[model samples]
Target: MSFITLFITASMPILKVLLISALGSFLALDSVDILGDIARKHLNKVVFFVFNPALVASNLAKTITYETFLTLWFMPVNVFITFLIGSILGWILTKITKPPKHLKGLVIGACSAGNIGKMPIIIVPAMCKEEGSPFGAVDVCQSYGLAYASLSMALGAILMWSYVYNIIRISSRDVVVEICASPSEGFDDTFKNSSKQPLLPSADYTSITTVNQSSFSSRMQQWLTTSIDKLNLKAILAPSTIGAIVGFVIGMISPFRKFLIGNSAPLHVVEDSAYLVGEAAIPTVTLILGANLLSGLKGSQIQYKIVIGIATIRYILLPLVGIFIVRGVVRAGLQLDPLLQFVLLLQYAVPPAMNIGTMTQLFGRGQSEYSVIMLWTYGLAAVALTLWSTMFLWLVAS
Candidate 1:
């Protein structure tokens, strides 16, 4: 396909996202009052707790197997690399822009995490269905594309909760002053107590030596508990993670796959039901995403530098880096599906994860700032995704 054809193919999915999101934005309007804050919140809960899990489990169960599973090993590594590189760029951005202390985490996070899951669920299959698509048959491409997207969503959740969650938390903790209204009073109290505590608590040298001489096993146990507590394992193993685990179990085991996967299976109804619920995930998430972004238009003023810097990091620089990374990996001898490679590249080019708003809401700060940043980044994403996707399709096809 020509570049123009590829660009059109790529734009269709993004345009659909924009259109659906626009409807969501419209519905969230004051006069419309349909998908308002409370409604979006309830709907988001459904997506996170129910729709997302079912979508992940069903898609993964149908497509993932020992062979495909092994082939996808590099995806997580690629995601981690995006976070690592984005963090580095974000740090540089912080140093240059010197945004407010409270807003620093928002900047880093906006730079670091992309909307890996939701965008792919919409984009990849839509591209596959296009007549000019280079990936084989439409149905096969979509099936595997969804499977790839589900895994991406699950992995993104784990990393977002564990990694990006902490960055925002620590940043929120730094700016917290007086007791204020927040989602968790207990969490704020912990932050307040830690803030008050001295960096090096005064202690007797004898007590220190005695503590150092304590049994290794007891110290190890204490260290393990602290590590787990800091990591927030509960969030790490989120509903989506659980769903992915269930899917992996079903996919990897031949007997389970036979019983639950195929149309002729004795237990196919269960799989069918899960898929039915899962089908709601994509459109619902896109709508919620649009509704949430409505706040960006009405929020407080933010530094244009921060927004522009993060946008450049996410849309321009990251995609270029991703192209090199994917091509290098191929050169190093790992054969990846054309579609898999496309999604990997797509991960780099997407806008920031929407969960940043949730973090700000939980912490009771920077809500306006996050909104302004999101408005611009996502507004620019339509163009960025189209250009990069066009290049990616042409490269993969050639």
Candidate 2:
């Protein structure tokens, strides 16, 4: 396919997202008042628990098999590298700009987790339909494309909920602690004052020894309790994560998959039902994204530089890194399908996941700032994705 044709094909899906997002934004306006904060929240809850999981499970059950899984092994690795590199960049940004403690997670998350799920699912199939597409027959291209997309969506959800969720949760807690702490009770003051205090006058040697032992035991018990509480696996195992897990099981296990997945299966209705519900996930998410942007536009104190920095990392630095990584993977003798390689490359270039906004809303921190960040990244995605995809197609085709 020519670069111009590829760019046109790639931009279609993004344009669809933008148009739906605009509708959402318009509906959220006070005059329209169709998708207000309360409405958006309720919709978000449904999407989070029901629509998202259903979409992920239904798609994966249909697409992934053991053979395809092996062929696409690099996908998970590619996603991990995006997260790792984005994180390193996020950390550097935090150090340089020193955003509020609570926003640290949001920043890192926005940097790390690209919109891996919907974009490729939408873009690749559209490209496959184009006359200039390099990938073979439409049905074959779409089938494989959906498989790659579904896998990316599933894995991305797991990583987002597990890794990004914890980071935001911890950072939010730290911010809360900071906000709640009184000046005199601050950590620095507590530590400095405690260190300067003279040692307790020696009591009877035996009494002192006993007291020290008791204190040590109490501290150890407290530490153990705190550690256990902090390692709350339930918090990390979010609905999306759970969905991904179930999807993987269904996809990888033959008997189970056969029973639930295909048209001929007795229980195919179960998959179909889930898929029907899951089909709503993309439009709902895009709408919520628009509604959230409305809020960001009204009033957001987020630094423009922070937003720019994140955009640069996600759109500029990461895509360049992805090109190298995909090339290296090919060089290392891994035979990835062209469409899959394009998906992998495009993954790096796409905007941050909408789930980050959901996370901030869940935590009640950085929602406006997050919205602002998302607004910019997604706004830029049309141009960014088109150009990068044009280049990626050219590179892969060569």
Candidate 3:
């Protein structure tokens, strides 16, 4: 297909995202007050706990088998590479732009993480449905597309909450201490309101009767327990993570696959029920994506140079490197699905992870700055995703 055809096919999905996002933004407006901060928070919880897990598990159960699962070993590596490269670039960006001390983590975190889960979940299947889509029959493409995307979502979540979460936490500690000591920094209202929340969830120290007088063994045990809690291990065991594990079990085990996956199976209703719930994940997420961006418009102290630097790293340079990494692997004799290749490349081009906002909230600073970055990068994402996605389709097809 010509570039125009591919561009049109790619842009269609992005356009849908933009439109729904616009509605989300509109509803979040003060006059509308429908998707305000509290509403978005509760809805986000629903998506995180309920809709997303169901989506991941149901799709994986339907399309994945042990053989196909084995072929996907490269994807997790691909996700890690994106993180590594983005981190390096982000570090370089911080040095060049020299943002405020508190903003360094926000900057680095934004550069390093991409919206690997939500964006792919929305874009991939939509691309498959397009009239000019290169992925072949619509139903087949959509099925396998969801499987690929669900796996990406699962892997991305594990990495983000563990790796990216730490990056923000470590960097934000200084700001947390500063706020605690002074309490007069004149941070934005959101930051001031959330300042009372602990930067890390505090461990109950009641068991330690006297910390200074504690025996070495007792102290060691206390330190170990606090270390585990501070690592935010609970996020690693999130609902989506559990869903992914369940999906893998269903997909890989012959008995589970036979029982739940096919129409002939006596228990296919279970899969159908999960699918019904999972289908809500995509639109709900896209709308929330828009609603979340409204905070960006409220204004903050972020430098435009930093925002531009992040955009360059995420949308331009990262995708270029991805082409080399993905194509190089394929050229060196590893076989991969064309659809998977497209997703790997698309992973590089997505905006920063939306969870960065949550991280900022957790650390009690940079919320305004993160909003500014999200506003610009996501605002730019429509054009960036369309063009890059078009190129990816053409490259894989050729």
Model 3 C-alpha lDDT per residue in residues 1-398, reported as the tens digit of each score: 99899999999999999999999999999999999999999999999999999999999888888999899999999999999999999999999999877788788889888999889999999999999987889999999999889988888888888888887888777634234544445556558689876665346454454554577768899999988887788997888889989999998999988888889998999999999999999999989989989989998877899999999999999999999999999999999989999999999999999998998998898998899999999999988999999999999999
Which ranges in model 1 have alpha carbons more than 4 Å from their true place?
A: 175-226
RMSD of each: 7.6, 5.2, 9.7
The estimated TM-scores of all candidates read: 0.89, 0.83, 0.89
Better of 2 and 3 by lDDT: 3
79-177, model 1: which lDDT tens digit per residue?
899889998899899999998887888889889988898889989888988888999999899889999998998889888989988888887775446
Minimum summed lDDT over a 10-residue window in model 3 is located at 175-184
Off by over 4 Å in 2: 173-232
Each candidate's lDDT (Cα)?
Answer: 0.89, 0.83, 0.91
RMSD in angstroms, candidate 2?
Answer: 5.2
Which 10 consecutive positions of candidate 2 have the poorest summed lDDT? Answer: 174-183
Model 3 RMSD, rounded to 1 decimal: 9.7
Which residue runs of candidate 3 sit more than 4 Å off their true CA positions?
175-216
Evaluated against the true structure, the overall lDDT of model 1 is 0.89
Candidates sorted by TM-score, best first: 3, 1, 2
